[model samples]
Target: MIQKSFCAIFLFVLGLGPISLTAQSLEIDADLRARFEYRHGFNNLFPDNADPAAFVNQRSRLNFNYTTEKLQLFIAVQDVSIWGDTRQILAVDGNDSFSLFEAWGQIQMNENWYMKLGRQVLTYDDERIFGGLDWAMQGRFHDAALLKYRKDGFMMDLGGAYSQETDRNDGNDFRIQGFFTYKALQYAYLKKSWEKSSASFLFLNTGFQDFDVNDVADGVSYRHTTGTYFKFPIKIINVTGSLYYQFGKANATTDLAAYQMSLEATYKKNKVLYGLGLELLSGTDQDGAAKNNSFFPLYGTNHKFNGFMDYFYVGNHANTVGLNDFYAKMVFTTGEKSTVLVKGHYFTANAALTGDADAYLGTEMDLVYTQALMKNVNLNVGYSHMFASESMSLIKGGRPHDNTNNWGWIQLIINPNIFKADLGTPSN
Candidate 1:
């Protein structure tokens, strides 16, 4: 019953353990991750005999935090699996991946305002378009309501959301099926900082739930996005930029315009770190164009963009043809907690490609290595390769040039903190 009333209001607020009204505090944390993979062509393309998909996935978390002086709270609980897919004597958990990733609260109404609400995490700024995907182990949330504003360096937020699937008595059909479900959402964010430069802006709106073809519920289809992000510095190079635009209606009969743009530059010396970038998304062609120019970066963290063996958009490119990444990277530091990263990409095809095919799609290489193994642990390793073409095997299928497209991985992370308290302040 609602997860037993959220575990009895989380053990009655963790047994009301640390409180003093104006100086309260409490914390507990944990997060464990595990990963291992060995797919042959990771997110697509590698067919000839097939049989290369090893596994081992995990992610477990527990977090609770609380504060006072106008309240603030958080809660998280997670579990994600895949090792042997359960079954070591289970009663019921054959794979629903336990969850409740976040539960929020924030109240502090004067002095710059605040009023967050439940199930949060809507990262902004360079996240392209809201993100907190946290490398996917079931890490994305938003059951919104916000109204925050900060001071000095400037900040602002105003959000909203509404979705339905239960507690019904009327109608507002949001029969949650997914692949990006949304029946309402609104957003606005703003940022400004200086001392080195910064800027941000966003305005989003989503709402989709229009069916009919005997599926009933027909009404709701709004899509709109607007964006901006930029950072500055130049004497030693460190620049960033982004621009976005998407118009309304991507459902209930298409009609959506799209766009995305990007720019990047980096420079660091002493331990190396150099980069370059380019990006553009806006597509629709392969001849089915009715009205829907593809440019979906919807909820960011698309595997941190373009390459990582995730072949486009992470959930399979929507509305096709879009993209034109061009990149370069470097990181090297290899010691005192190690580091290394090497990257490259050069894909193309931002429209038109289905007649004699070939808009040059292919080329990727990525390598990663990181180590820290202490103070909360960490380790990661990676590999990737993909050099297809023939138009990426004519839009991602197989063969065409498949020299065993590649991918490999390993990861481990642990975050610990397990408890803290301090109810200081309040004497006579």
Candidate 2:
């Protein structure tokens, strides 16, 4: 089966020869990455294990690209596996399998028009709300089609996707989205030298299986988001601020109307950088009962938010107790080849109307350092410590005797440019 699949892929590439020849261009590029990670006190979050432990994981990826005058193609595959003692405890399916990460094709209709089809990563505005989540071992992807139009400082996007509905035995699901943005730095910010400032609006509509087995109704979900960001230089300091608002509804019994908002400020000077942020989620106490608030983390990448030991999202516990995060961060560069980062966060549990008015609190501290070993090699080490309040600990099923949780990891990356040949820039 593997051999057959390989042959099919090769044939598809060779079939493009006619177009490549007419364009009088041929270019190919590839990238390979490997990483190893170790974690301590990783299993304490699970109910079965409260003791500290250690484990290792290895991951690898390969990417291919082909470009012509009016068309482009890309594909990537990844494999992740456990190593040493970790394999014994976290046995995965199919003996460390490999899967397709991305497979997409783009066609340029004109200088300002393009269309893309197949699986790809969708990222916008610092990857806060719509992101690729590239930091994780297994990145996120969407199987969809996208169309984009650009002219001067104006842009527009439209996309849609469908997935197999697990709740419904019929295997039917649906998704649709539309987005628009306008950017003008010179007019909006009055700063001609600064990068562009822009505002975006997105509308999403999705359908899912009904909860009741016999119900004829199809669950429909809707979401709307608006966001903006600006960059300006004051004296020797470069500053930026970003904000977002999301309103949406789902089939869950909880209030369908939920919202999230956040504000971030950062300053950079010389080799030092500092940042501060605040995020809040509104509480919903409808039906005179405990109402759960929706927390989307739209403006903040949940994957990058390491507080709570990454237990909520990683363990699928985010639906339970709500989260409100406050954070501060700093970074310093050493010479030109190394840098260090430190961050701290405070978390509080939101109150549901009928439930406890005051829930819990937690704190997290993180430290990381990165060094360039060579032109193509780099190393990173990180440590994190989490302290949960009594309220949080109890709800999380943690024993009162347990005061804290800790985790650490080390990684190495090597990327070398194997081939580079320009096939002349194509004119669309």
Candidate 3:
């Protein structure tokens, strides 16, 4: 399988080399990353008699980019897998983790306007509302159409998408099970940048397929999120903040009302950078109103916001008692090629806990060291420890909080450019 993967990369370069030489420009690149992790209690409290889990996962990708005077095309293919998931001498890959990450094209309408369509990524300011979730192995992509405008320091983007189970002509029901996705989506983003500051606004609407009690598709339930993000410098400290509100129906029968707010400040002194931040996500009480009040980050990179241990909002914690996170961070530049980062997070429930339990969830500490091994190559090592309170155990299925909870990981990332060329212009 490894040899076959290499052969595929080789063939891609060979097949596109001649055609690229006659076009305006073409570039090919590859991204490879492998990570090993040891988790005793990674995302939850450690069970008393459970053993630790350890594994290695990898992501391999190849990207091709072609550019002309008025058009740009990009395609990315990726494979994500866990080591030893497939048999050594197998003829077929049982894991079946290969996929198309992105394939999109943009056509220039004029000097400052363009249209982009196909499977692409939407990453906006601070990524609090809409983001390209790159921390996960599969990342995130959308099949959508976009109208973009950029001029001076102002930018605006309008995007929309509709999803279906297949090309069936009979019905419009999206019945693919086990995957949580939107049936229809629309969003608008606007931004303005100054010399030292920037501000952006986003309005997003998402529609989910609503089903009746008989397991039949009934209609679509819609949710709306609107927010603004700002970043500016205050003397020696840099400040960043975001405010967002969510409304509309959560499903066929539930009404939604939620909000999220965050603020952070950072300053650099000598070889160290110090930072502090707070994030508040509204939540529904244990026995509160019937409406859904829990806030969800939707498509954003939740890992980047919460603790790295993924205690909240990685895959779970949605529609639950939301989060209140207070964090502090410090980064030390040890040398020209290496750096160390240490961060601490204190967590609590935004709503009342069951049985009048304590609201304090726990505290977590994360340490990471990164070294530049070579050009386009880097090494990262990290360790995290969670000090869980009794409240945490209550929320995590009554697991004992006295068990030691920690996690460790190491990763290597390599991104290499394979080819680049510019062939003056296209011939008519």
Candidate 4:
């Protein structure tokens, strides 16, 4: 297998020297990322029973694209692994070490209509409720079909997906990691943009497989989520906000009524950018057998919110008392190629707490500095510190160990175009 991974600048080196005037194009895109991380306390304060961990993780990918007047095709292959695993990775089976990351095709139905089907990534707006989650080594993709329409300043997309009833690799269809995905899904997304502002609306439905109580009834849990994300600029300040509501049964037996809200403002002047924001996700009432009020941003890029340490609402924070996050952030540019970012966050519970826990959760501080190494290469370093509270300790299900204190990391990113061939009349 060949993998072309690098920055867009590398594409120039892979371009074909000669072309026809047929207006057809073929291109290759590659991304190579390697990161080494060391942590005494990465995700949470380790509970004394665990030790510090370190690892070097990397991701490599190569994608091919073919485009014509009304037809398009794409295929992406990828491999992700830790350093020193092995010189030769066996990929005949379904594993993260090697796989087809994406394979999709698109057809233009009319002047403003298009349809796409296959394994692909879906992202919209600020990525609060839906996203690709590219920061992870394996990233994220869905096997689905999407119908799209675009005209002027407005766009619309409708998508649907279905998975097999089990995890076994059957005669046809991929496993989809079984329990990790829904059995069925449907969604609609719409967006409109003006000169200085933009807004989006989305509605999603998902159903997951479950075990029946008596092994004789239906075993599908269904949920519905709807939301809006909007942004506008007023004078020197930019304002952005998002709100979402979740309803319907979380399972055949559990009823849910949950929601989320967030708001932010930013100012950019001279060489510095400053911002302040708040986010709230409703939690289940401790006294409730009536309904579940804990919100879950199912497909969102959870790693980007709450805090960089990802202590809450990433994966395991579901159905529990949710969170309230208030934060302030600033970015300073030094010279033309480097920038520094600093942020502070105060967290609490959106609802009541467990045990004698007060509403006060904790505070955290994060810092990062990034520099461009070259056209398509960059370097980043970051550090974060978390101060745990009684409520946090209670929620974490452990005594507040001295561990939730600090964490640090460094990463390198390089992307390059590996090859390009053109046909038809060249724009140049």
lDDT winner among the candidates? Answer: 3
The candidate scoring highest on TM-score is 3
Give each model a TM-score: 0.35, 0.79, 0.95, 0.89
Question: What does candidate 3 score in Cα RMSD to the true structure?
Answer: 2.4
Regions of model 3 farther than 4 Å from truth: 1-23, 177-179
Candidate 1 local Cα displacement, residue 342, angstroms: 29
Task: Please give the lDDT score for candidate 4.
Answer: 0.81
**Positional deviation of 33 in candidate 4, in angstroms?**
0.5
lDDT ranking, best first: 3, 1, 4, 2
Flag regions of model 2 displaced more than 4 Å: 1-15, 20-49, 84-93, 165-196, 214-219, 223-243, 252-254, 283-292, 298-301, 306-308, 312-317, 352-360, 398-401, 422-428
Model 2 lDDT, residue 373, Cα: 91
Q: If candidate 1 were superposed on the true structure by all CA atoms, what would the RMSD be?
A: 23.0
Separate clash counts for every candidate: 0, 0, 0, 13
What's the residue-level lDDT of 6 in candidate 3? 52
Once model 2 is optimally superposed onto the true structure by TM-score, how far is the C-alpha of residue 33 displaced, in angstroms?
A: 4.6
Q: In candidate 2, what are the lDDT values of residues 266-303, reduced to their tens digit?
A: 78778988988866654443224344455454323456
> lDDT of candidate 2 vs native?
0.57
By the lDDT metric, which is better: model 2 or model 4? 4
Give the alpha carbon lDDT tens digit for every residue of 1-428 in model 4.
Answer: 33333333235323533333346777887788898877755566667767777888888887778777777778777889888775556543234387778889899889999999999999898777788888787888988999999999999999999887555653323334342378789999999999989999999999876555565435567799998999999899999999999998877788989999999999999999999999999997444447889888888788888888888866667788888999999999986999999999999888787553588778989998999999989898999888877677756767564565677888898888877776565454
- Point out the higher-scoring one by TM-score: 1 or 2: 2
